[model samples]
Target: MTEVAEICSELLRIDTTNDGGGDGPGERRAAEYVAGLLDEVGIEPHVFESAPGRTSVVARVPGDDPDGLLVHGHLDVVPADPAEWRVHPFSGEIADGCVHGRGAVDMKGTLSMTLAWARENARRGARPRRDLVLAFLADEEATGAYGAGHAIERHRDLFEGCSEAISESGGFTWHEGDVRIYPVAVGERGTAWMRLTARGVAGHGSKPAVDNPVAELARAVARLADHRWPVRLTPEVARLIDELSRALGAPIDVDRLEEEIRRVPRAAALFRGVLRNSANPTMLNAGYKVNVIPGSAEAHVDGRFLPGQRDEFLETVDRLLGPKVTREFVSFEEAVSSPAEGLFDDLTAALLAEDPGGRPVPYVMTGGTDAKWFARIGIRGYGFAPLFLPPGLDYFGMFHGVDERVPVEGLEFGVRVLDRLLSSESSTM
Candidate 1:
């Protein structure tokens, strides 16, 4: 527990804030720190950069069995503003029984736990039944272009023979009606980041123009923002609804599924975003000068679609954008889903053993992760960081949020759960 908290605090101190694209202070420093820790335990980690300063580290521990397992996490974090936070965003202050920093909960806490567990195993010369591959990735806050995406494209051999992987955002405690439910991610919504452009004749602001591109773009953005997306459940979400209903002892009526889903507090939060594809206007650009109307107005949208909903999502976007507006994908990644039946039992057992009151459930993430990139190589990825958080904490708000922190106890709990899973005989069973 002490070592876990120490490692998490150390990792948080190193500011690896990823500002997207090729910008920001890359992950080289943080990767070097992680590599140093691994090296101290007699394991030589492979540290490489996809682009200049964009570093990622990978290492493996041999086991008795030939099959492989991957444990991965991101080194980069989203940019945080100091002015908006109570403490300096990069301070890494350990106070109030929590490790306070930007990436404490979003990832570095889990990264530290993985590192500590691996280092401990290396020190004791203890190995599991299958090879354990550890990957500390970069550029996850943006797309994984310089992280997992780069690794899969340039260094495919590193993950060869690895059938499954576990990473962030899962195995955490969720309280609902006196039941502590742990929702492990089995699926992620597809990313459909698009840019919308509306074109019209340039004119002075004082002169009234019926065909104003800015006005048209604003209207389109408003429509997309206000549109009530219809509920369309994917298989993963449907399973979640059914399982949650049974777990809560509230049998769902299929004819009135939406009503029942809303009735369950846990189901409402987990299924709302996944029940429908979503598109939100994020950035907008038009004229530079106040007096002149630009001929073209452009806006960026953050879009997410469920599995098998791509065509319908795109068609809806086209209709909302109207005739003058044209759209193109800035970045796109397909939705990923993995079978949770057999694999889930192990995850559930681990959580239940640690805290008998916990009930593990399967849910879909509303956003994307490096898991999407790994899916291309035929490797299934599950979001299973394994933290046992208390009821008072807003776990989801910590991601890219102000004054982000993770409970010291939660970090310790995660270390134990990860150790149990990694040291187990068979993760598949």
Candidate 2:
């Protein structure tokens, strides 16, 4: 296999699924694999565990004191079903110029690039102007409680004075039919996970049951999925609109911006299904036997918030899911609060230099990430996992979808951009 293919395969073989399901919880073997590789390259890793098996490791390529840049990616990923997937999720198959498996896209692909970079930089003894911190984290697929959350809570000093960090998104090569644009995620929406339960009368399935809990759960699920999140206009969205206007060479109505946003290559992905506040009924529990109608049913919903809109998001959630639902932070990552001033300047220059035809626009990921944890310590989190995807390929759908994979060439392209970024961003500081 080629280099990028190799990276994807190796990571795929690691089986780092998150706590929501599958092979995760304890990142021991996966973390050890990364830590061992870094060790081979002579970087001592600082490994921390939140629980037996759960782990987050940090290896610093030491640089100037006080302010360092952290490059992070999570190890855990959402579970995959072999029955639904074309390839075994953990088989780490490299085929047809792509690496196929779970975490291949949602991250592991990006993580592999970071690992490759560590080797490239370490081999050259290249010294960053600021300390370069590499975090091979776990539990991001869950709440990050055992991964980044634990690291921040327990190993705050390791990230001491970190000003900014980069992670597994954005800055990748995107193939528009005519243009290649790298959408850098400067921010992400906050997450609010809620648990809902409906309790009613239990009865024999043979008998016509009324007020059945299962029926209530089905209603609640419909309510959550049908409820729309209020359209929020954020600084990131405004920037995106500006870019699209220039690209289309016409005034794309801001009111119908959602449709216009979809016109831009993969970013049309940003306008995915239900392009608003969303609540998903991910899990459901009911009666065990067919002979009985369960009296109690439960479900979990994932909701998101725009930056500085957490309180408002909470209010919306309360109104939509109903007060009976138990609201909680399934995965809480604060939306980037501060403006990305110099950070974007450097990133934009890098993208422009790499793909002059490509547009580097600001984006706000609708999901949560470890970036939220880093943002807490005064570190600005930018999703800059560079990739150049070919047209017609739905990149977002590959998050954990069947035959999840990354382009062989795209990985190489990402490494080139990352190399320039690490070189350019570090020197400028």
Candidate 3:
């Protein structure tokens, strides 16, 4: 097995499961393991704890250029059930030429590639073209309050000269016939985690109440779920579509985008959730007893908006929900968009250098990441955790899915691509 695969397996074995509540085993152990790995390469790493066991690690590799490049990956994984998987979720078993585990694809495998790249550079006594800031963050699966948020709030000086960052959710191989397409993320949709409440009269089971909060809330939830958001294309997605048109030699109608996406099966997964805003009711709460009518009802929604469309999204949502239900934000963050012209050129060059036929395109991520936190400090973040996968692997479906895994060969391929990216000189910095 390659060292990168081994490292990923070991990381998967350490259960850094963040249940979003303060329940799961924290990331302290994983932070320490990463710190030890950096120490082996004669690099000093600083480990910080936001709370008792919520931990993060940061280390810098000084380089010839003054410009800094931040490479970050989270240590947390969403909770997984062992009984639901082909192999135990936390077993980190190497089976069928893949590393099988909960975090093998969500993030741990990508982190392993970065760790391997740093260690390999140390072995050769080489430094990157620009200053490299490596951060292993915590609480990413949750609010990121204890991870990137904490680091920026308390220790912003640690990332002094850094302007650009590369993290998860992009730069993986997507095969279409003989074509290898790499979608590097240039932006992400904004988050609007909301809580809705409906107020009415509390009554006995037999009483015929005029105002039932439970019914009101259920109707609002249904309306929100049934509303079909229209396509609001941002620059990042437009660029992706344009490139896909040229690469696949398929004509795409901007007016009939949904139909066009359906025609190109390979681009459907990448374009599905990102073309417009979306909201789904995830949780609901009402009366304690089935027979009792509740005074108030509450529901939670996972809402996402395309870049530059937050206000419009909220207005439409309010219209759909009606005034019977009131809404308040549980968590709200702006969409992050990076320039597609400069540093992206460097990323594309690096990918093509390793795989000449690989076509690199820019896309907006449907979900948020720790990148949102970094964007607060004026840092541009790109989702680029390079991986080369075989055609049959359902790469996108593996995130927080059953039987999550990463191919062994993909990890090694990522390490080489990372090395090339770090070696290349770019004017963006």
Candidate 4:
């Protein structure tokens, strides 16, 4: 089998689901399998178990320069609903020329690419200006507490002598008239997962009561969804937009732009979603029966904030919901700082070399990842899962959607681009 095929098969065979996290993040089988390959290639791999079953493996590619580079990816994937997938989530089935499985595009495909590149480099006795670190982590779906987060907190020495790193993120295709500029992800939004408690007096459902928490909670949820935050343009984001506009050979007028953004269907649909502070009430709890008016209601929200905008975002949400709603943060991760365009140009070259007709663009990730945690320790990461998604497919919607599968050629394209970038002088890593 080819490198992409082999790694894809290996990843599919291991069910590193996050549901097994309590007993350890369930990456033991996957990590061990990856270790075997490293051993075969003469690279001593270090495997650590955060919990009973959650295992993390780290391997380094010896380089010419003393400066070290770390390429990290999560082994654990979010639980896949078996009933929803066309192929068995763990079957590693290659149908219609594409590998079908959980974590295929999320990061596993990228991991496979990195592994194959490392092995080939080692075999050729090829070394770069810096050492290369490959970390296959566990427990990213929930938090990095057991994975990359743990590595940074517990094994700080593991990343010693490293100046730069690249991970799965920030690089993807976007159509803007005629230009296809690949955007190397420079930053991400901060993550805030919060729980809110709404309290009121309980009463009989038959008797109309005013102090019902459920009613109050419904109002709060509506406002959270409908409310919009003011747009704050940061340098990187503005540059990304400007580059895209320039590449398309279109003029951007800052004053009427907001109106244009709100009116233009395609541009509005894509850019507006992740532009500002966002609040989503994903889980809710209230009365158990159909007749009772619950005294208290509980709900959890997945909120994201731009860099340095957390304080304002929380304040706004609090005010909009009124004093009845009290919130507590379950987890808080800050937005990461992004690198400049020079690195991105190298990525564009990588993409062009692989497929000359493909278009790449910069994006502002509306979600959070291990990249949030790595920023503090001086590591720059991006959300770069490269693919040639069809126009009508809605790439963003596929993440938690049913039948999530990547094209076979898209995977190959990404592997080739990534490998080319890794070996080039232009790549910061």
Candidates 2 and 4, the one with greater lDDT = 2
If ranked by lDDT, best first, what sequence of candidates would result?
3, 1, 2, 4
lDDT-better candidate, 1 vs 3: 3
Off by over 4 Å in 2: 1-5, 19-26, 64-66, 83-87, 198-222, 258-267, 271-275, 286-297, 321-333, 424-429
What RMSD, rounded to one decimal, does every model reach? Answer: 2.4, 3.6, 2.4, 3.3
- Residue range 55-153, candidate 3, lDDT tens digits: 999999998787899999899999998889989999899989999999898899999999998887877788788999999999999989989999999
- Best candidate according to TM-score: 3
Clashing pairs in 3: none
Which of the two, 1 or 4, has more TM-score?
A: 1
TM-score of every prediction relative to native: 0.94, 0.85, 0.97, 0.88
**Higher-lDDT candidate of 1 and 4:** 1
10 residues in a row with least lDDT, candidate 3:
420-429
TM-score of 1: 0.94
Residue 93, candidate 4: C-alpha displacement in angstroms? 1.5
**TM-score of model 4 relative to the true fold?**
0.88
Candidate 2: 10-residue stretch with minimal lDDT: 420-429
3 against 4, candidate with superior lDDT: 3
Writing each residue's lDDT as its tens digit, candidate 2 over 1-429 gives: 555568668878877767565236437888888888789888999987888788778988877454788899998888778899887988888778788888888898898887877777677777655678899888887777778888888898888767889896678655555656677787887776777777778888998877787876787678767876667677676776667556545665668756766565354665342235556678887889999888788888776667777777667666665544445565555566445568777777777766778877777787878888877777888888878787766777787678888888878777766677775233211
